[model samples]
Target: MPILVEVSKGLLTQEGEREVFPKIAAALLEAHGLTGNSFMTPNVIGHVSVKPESECFVGGKSQSLAVVEVTVPAITFPNGQVAQKFIGEVTDIIDTYKAKPHPRERTYVVVKHAVDGPWGIGGKAYSNADLGAAIQKAAMA
Candidate 1:
């Protein structure tokens, strides 16, 4: 799983920016009921990109927006309920730390699932089953 967080520059406090990834990971793992899974630990990987408000845009016009985009293998979410909850939690994380008074609509959360056999890690292509097995193996170690 990879989470990409993009926020308009200065929209979040320095501390908030530093805390975003862990916040997202915690919410995601809890939502998926994998909070304590050894292989699905809180050490989830993510990245944050902050750009000037002038450099970020909505509808072709620059705007103060906070976007959290999560990409995971198709099997990760497993169902609409889990996916929906995850997206909501993601939005909540951004909403909590974003500059005060930012419009609710300006906070966006998206989840994209890579098709089986295309998601890769450690230089190897992994189908959903392969990834599941790998995770299981890691948990047992």
Candidate 2:
């Protein structure tokens, strides 16, 4: 189960690189109890990409969101039951970060399950607040 975790921080603040991204990643890995090879294992491949928050927009509106796109191979779960569990586990991690008190701006964190075989699970738009909840919900379903 190669799970790819892609993290992208918005340019909403200058401290995103120095503070936000590392915090999010640390929370995620800790929540999963993944260490050593387990953390790097192909069961889940994680990637982090950061950019200025102003660049992300929707409907002509600038979205000051730091997006963390999580992609996991659908085949890894085989059945919906397993998929749900996996999703839930990841979601919990995101939720923890969302609960943190920080700037008033919106930061989107999304978890996308590659349903089309091994490569189709793309990224989704998520907020720092919704990251964990969304991922948990998707996995439990």
TM-scores for all candidates? 0.86, 0.40
For candidate 1, give the lDDT of residue 53.
90
List candidate 1 segments past 4 Å from native: 138-141
Model 1 Cα RMSD, 1 decimal = 2.1
What TM-score would candidate 1 get against the native? 0.86
Off by over 4 Å in 2: 1-15, 36-54, 74-105, 115-141
The 10 consecutive residues of candidate 1 with the worst lDDT sum are 35-44
Worst lDDT 10-window in candidate 2: 34-43
| Clashes per candidate, residues 3 or more apart or on different chains | 0, 20
- What is the per-residue lDDT of model 2 for residues 67-121, given as tens digits with 9 covering 90 to 100? 4555543323346654455445444444444333423234344445554432322
Could you tell me the TM-score of candidate 2? 0.40
